[model samples]
Target: MTNWYKSWEEFHTSLSKHQNQTHQLFRLRSSTSVSQRNKQEVHVYAWMTSQESGQGPANDFVQQVDTTRGSISRFGTKNVGTHNHSLGRRQFDNHPSNRRIDEPGLVELVRDLSSACSKAKLIMQHLRLKSGQYAQKQSLYVYAPIIAHTQSYLILGKQATLRDVHNLVAKLKAMRNGSASVEERLKARLREFCTQSGNTATVFIDDAKTAQTITLQSQQMRRFFKAFPEVMLVDATHNTNDAMFKLFSFMVHDVYRHGQYVQHSLMENESEECLRDAISAFKEFNPTWEETKVIIIGKDFGELALLEREFSQAKSFVPFSCKKKYLRTEMTKREYGGTNSLNTKRAEDSIDMMLKATTLDEYTIGLKCLFYLLDNVKLRAEDPVPHPKHTFLQYFMRNWGSCRQLWAAFGRAGIPHLGNNRRARDFMGYLKDILKSTMGLDECVDTLIFLQSVLRT
Candidate 1:
């Protein structure tokens, strides 16, 4: 009865004013029952306030209170002990055994491993070094940081030192050739230098055949228009070897868009068929080429006629004629006292002058020099002076006789000879200035630009 009342709050409340003290007795009964079950505490209060207010039937209320009292007694006596045993069984499964590394420890371990790896790499490199290997090895391993520093100096138009290269090589050795290390370092260095200094490094590769193949595949004459669309300059020169003359057509390209000649090619020999073949080669490269786009053809009078017949739609500008007139003037100036005949000493003097002038200017100085030499020979012939077996006129005529035709062609094209001796001297001085200002691989491009700019001015 005490257990029944202990779980039944409605029964105590239904007792009215006498039930207040009975409710206190029910609480004492709940404490005693909880202690007898498992030494655990349990609270027994009104489950529903409406039931306590006598709103339901008494019999139904009493039955509900009895069922709840049985459920509480069974749970406290059986379920609570079973739940504690089950929690003990799952203790290992609920929690992990091993403790993970903290963030600071993991970071330190990584740093230590990296350091050890670097030291190992250095030791391996030291082991590999031998007295014999240094003499045979030509390939170098350049580093990124060192190359970067070298490029910085290069960008400021300064040359990289041997110390810079040595430092880079040392870094590369330390890296143990990590991820694309060599290629990445080279590419980065090239990109920085090429972008800032406009210089290209000439890397010598093992494949000579591949280099030749690339040159042939990249045929400048055939791909002239595609490579340089703006302005194309075409000219032809004749060369004599073993007293036989061979004509060579050439085309100049302005690739940098800086109004400077970048590339050249030998088109064909001196014949109508060869000229036609040259035209065909050009057409093969650019099928859409029209007569108007042909622009200019700077050639000799003989080739001029053939060029006109072949490319009638194109306009031809002759700069070599002025060159020839200049040469003839110089020749006449040398012929004041003597006739067209040249003496032995005079011929030798003339040859020396021609060779000297040839190195001074590109077109004019050469033509004028050759003209003066030839005129000196003509003066000696009129005088009829007997000379040795090896005469200047005879030597020049035998070896480089065809060069006269080259000069005449230059003159016919209206290209002035490097003017007078004073002008030639000035041009040489300009060339010397360029040579002085330019250094390293950049000299090639700089010299070309200097020449073009001088000509334009």
Candidate 2:
């Protein structure tokens, strides 16, 4: 008996020899036969030779085993029958011979199972590829549309950034060539694809001259006043050069809905004609001037007569005494050297402080200064004889004098007025905060909605 275990090399050598050899047979017989009634039977047989049998060596040997065993004692016949049965069973289990017994069905089953596993693997691979491609495609789709629709222009004679365009082209190239070389043939193919897809290969350069002309035309002074029918606040400050004219603008409270229209033009001289022209231009822009209302808020009566003549059909000319209105009312009454005296220097100083108050902290400091000035004014007003030399100091003592009366006058007429710089600054600060915190257009809309809700409440 040989050991069943062998190394792969040793097993291969043994298997190779077994395949080349003719068929091998072994026989076994029982010790007793039923016919002889417990008598032992001995059987002798000779296997046939291939040359004499005229059959192949392997077939002759197999047939000889069957004949010899079958002709022996009954015990030998039984042994031969069992061997024959095993041989027939093997005919359905082994290779070519087993192929006859629904072999195609077995082959197909194996092929089908292999095919199913292969298809499943392929599907998983395809899904992974598609997921990656989809992400890439999505990014390209988003940015490409923006680039295609982007309005390009040159500023200071320099071209605008083309980073988006370059990025798009790079992404398109990457999509076409995953791991392949970027050959001329591939480029030609890409060009053809772009053309078919309505994507132009040429980059159109924006004309600087044309862009400038368009921008100027777009920015031309147009009638935005119709949309906001309220008092226009007119004030002027000379710039460092003092050559060119620039007017500072502010809208009165009612100007947002309906009120007086005010305008300013910085002339070499504060002439009546310059004022008239400014008022005329304003009225021209306000075509509904016949239907609409007008109120002019000026620092003084500088252009009052001209405005009245220009807008004769409109309401009364309301003179806004910045000194009396803002300085006195906003600064506690005691600050203006008593409510009786209107001092110019103190008013100027208060206005300067208000202008300097840029931040919230600075604004609080200015208010504190105003409080101190108001207290000083009250002390002076109580004096038996107010010091004439303290005229500069007395202006601060008056607390803006009759400015409060002006505010009341407008208020009675259902007109809105931002009485002082502090109030204007506060409103501006609120607007700034709203703009800074807003995320985007949607957020801005949400903020407006929230404001509307708050107003309703």
Number of clashing pairs per prediction, in order: 29, 22
lDDT agreement of model 2 with the native = 0.37
Span of ten consecutive residues with least summed lDDT in model 2: 211-220
Query: What is the TM-score (0 to 1) of candidate 1?
Result: 0.24
In candidate 1, where is summed lDDT lowest over 10 consecutive residues?
Answer: 209-218
Q: Estimate each model's TM-score.
A: 0.24, 0.26
Give candidate 1 misplaced runs (Cα > 4 Å): 1-224, 227-230, 238-268, 291-301, 320-457
lDDT to native, each model: 0.36, 0.37
Model 2 Cα lDDT, one tens digit per residue, 132-246: 3443544422111112225652111111123322332334335544565423433454355345322222111134421100000000122334445444444433331113332
Among these predictions, the greatest lDDT belongs to 2
lDDT, residue 223, model 2:
33
Estimate, for each residue in 1-457, the C-alpha lDDT of model 1 and write its tens digit. 3424554576555554353433333333443564555433222234345457876434322222356556532122223324432233133222232111122433243345333333334432332232113212433232111225545521111122334323433444345435654335444544543453323222222244211000011222334445554334454333211122232323333344332222222222355654555555445445445533333443333566676666665444433343434334443443332335444355444444443343323333443444455443232222333332323334445534444433333322333322222322233344444432212222222333334335435
Angstrom error of the Cα, residue 454, model 1: value is: 24
Q: After superposition, which runs of candidate 2 have C-alpha atoms over 4 Å from their true positions? A: 1-221, 240-266, 291-301, 313-321, 324-407, 410-412, 416-457
